[model samples]
Target: MRYAKFSMDDPFISMAEVRALVEGEVHFLAGVALLPDGREKIASRSSTVKVSGKLLSASHDPKEVNEAIRGRCFSIYPDVILGRDKNMFRALYSEATKGVETSKRCPKLDLVFTDGVIVAGIREEERDSKSLREHSMKPFSQSGTMDPFTSRLMVNLARVRKRVLDPFVGVGSILLESAWMGLDCVGVDVDPSMVTKAKANLSHFNYQCHVIQGSVTSLNLVGGFHVVTDPPYGRSSSAKGATLRELYAAFLSVSAELMERGGRLVFASDSREDWRDEIRSAGLKTVSTHLIYLHKSLSRAIYVVERG
Candidate 1:
């Protein structure tokens, strides 16, 4: 079995997105999720799933936890971390790892306590360039620009094959994450200023991607098997003189043309409409939908669709 620990702050989105990415049966414990071993292979490109590795052992007793880590190579000492319980697990972890051996040339070990159990596993290191915190200062940003973590989460959930397309790319947040994952990226925007800003933002991070100043309704390109974007909904930017319903309908129609068969599309919208008619008209099937409540008046909906 392999253990995947998620960030506790946003458990709903984290669980939903990861469930879409991985295959096979996944059992969710308190703060960690267990995936069937050898059936899943992720490149470790996630913001919510912080740690993942082969399960070494799971136990409730302190002595059994100590026995589980016996003779394991660790750089310095294993760090005990909490997933749920704070006060009680701290002392139990302290007793479990007392006088443990460590080496300088070995991987670090982490003990995660959650749901009244201690799970010991080797921590997987992530690529620093793909981190969202690296580029805190963006060249251009709007009021409702998607954050790097959420943007990358959508990209990962799209199940990208080779190339990624963002039809409503604003400042290239989604494109930046796609490029970092070593995938070909193309972005389009109706506003010329947004096109320039998106290019600048991608260049600042030393990522190469194609950006075009065009509307999604008339986008004349193909070969983006995965499409992820956050469209303008009159909050951060205008819909370029089109109503929300009209923009969404046109965008979905063009998206069906740009994508190959079985291609995946993930997008965010604040409209409460279910979009069943638009999705069916475009010959696309709705795979899943996730709703995130931001405030009393606003809630964002993420839709995953597949071209048939």
Candidate 2:
């Protein structure tokens, strides 16, 4: 088994997003998760580690903790450092590795502590936040453009192997991240200016993505695409002469037709209307929904839907 440490950026949303990315059973424990081994590569914006064992209900005694680390470090090479939730516990590092380093292997063991519970493991994968930030701050940015981390999460949630489509790609935030993940991305925007800006942003990052000025409702694109986008929320952005409900219904209706069978659609919106009927009527199934509380009076809902 492996333990995955999640970013505290809305743990509920993070957990839900991670659940969609990872296969097999996943059990949650506070801010950490126990995932099946060999399935760690699918993790994005989260760190996965090989779990050696756990010190359940650990006491406050530092010596006992050091002893536990020593026992688990017997097989670990190139030394093992004491870490608490991805942060190094330098005070205990010396004590934990008194004589553990007996080889020259590069991989080190990480002992993660959450709520006084210690989980010994080796760090395997984590998201590149620095690059994500650089891509998000493009030449042109808008108010409702999706955040870089959330964009990556949505793309990963879609589980697209090669390509993704964004019907409402404003400034190309989602497309940028999608291309960074080595996926071919295409985006369409109703406004010509927004389309130009999106194309420029992708070019600035040297990502060859396709950005077109067209309405999503009338988009006649190839089928078999995993659609992931953040539709305009009707605030700080135009709804294209349609109510939020009607806009979503039309988008879902067309997206359902474009996406391949079993292709997933992950979108975020501020609309509170239940889209179950509209989603089902469009030949799609609602996989899951997550409410992200941004602040007072503004919470966004992330919907995960799949073509049936």
TM-score of each: 0.85, 0.79
Give per-residue lDDT, candidate 1, residue 25: 83
Distance from true position, residue 108, model 2, in Å?
4.2
Best by lDDT: 1
Could you tell me the lDDT of residue 75 within candidate 1? Answer: 58
After the best TM-score superposition of candidate 1, give how far the Cα of residue 299 lies from its true spot, in angstroms. 2.8
Global Cα RMSD, each model: 3.2, 5.4
Which stretches of model 2 miss by more than 4 angstroms? 42-108, 235-240
Question: 125-208, model 1: which lDDT tens digit per residue?
Answer: 332434687654678887778888788789977888688899998888899889988999999999899999999998998999
List the candidate 1 regions with Cα displacement exceeding 4 Å. Answer: 36-44, 61-64, 73-84, 87-99, 102-106, 126-130, 235-241, 271-273, 293-296
* TM-score quality measure for candidate 1: 0.85
The prediction achieving the highest TM-score against the true structure is 1
Model 2 Cα lDDT, one tens digit per residue, 92-210: 44555565543435444555555544555565665566677697678889666777877887887788888799999888888988888888889999988989998888889899888
- As a whole number from 0 to 100, the lDDT of residue 110 in candidate 2 is 51
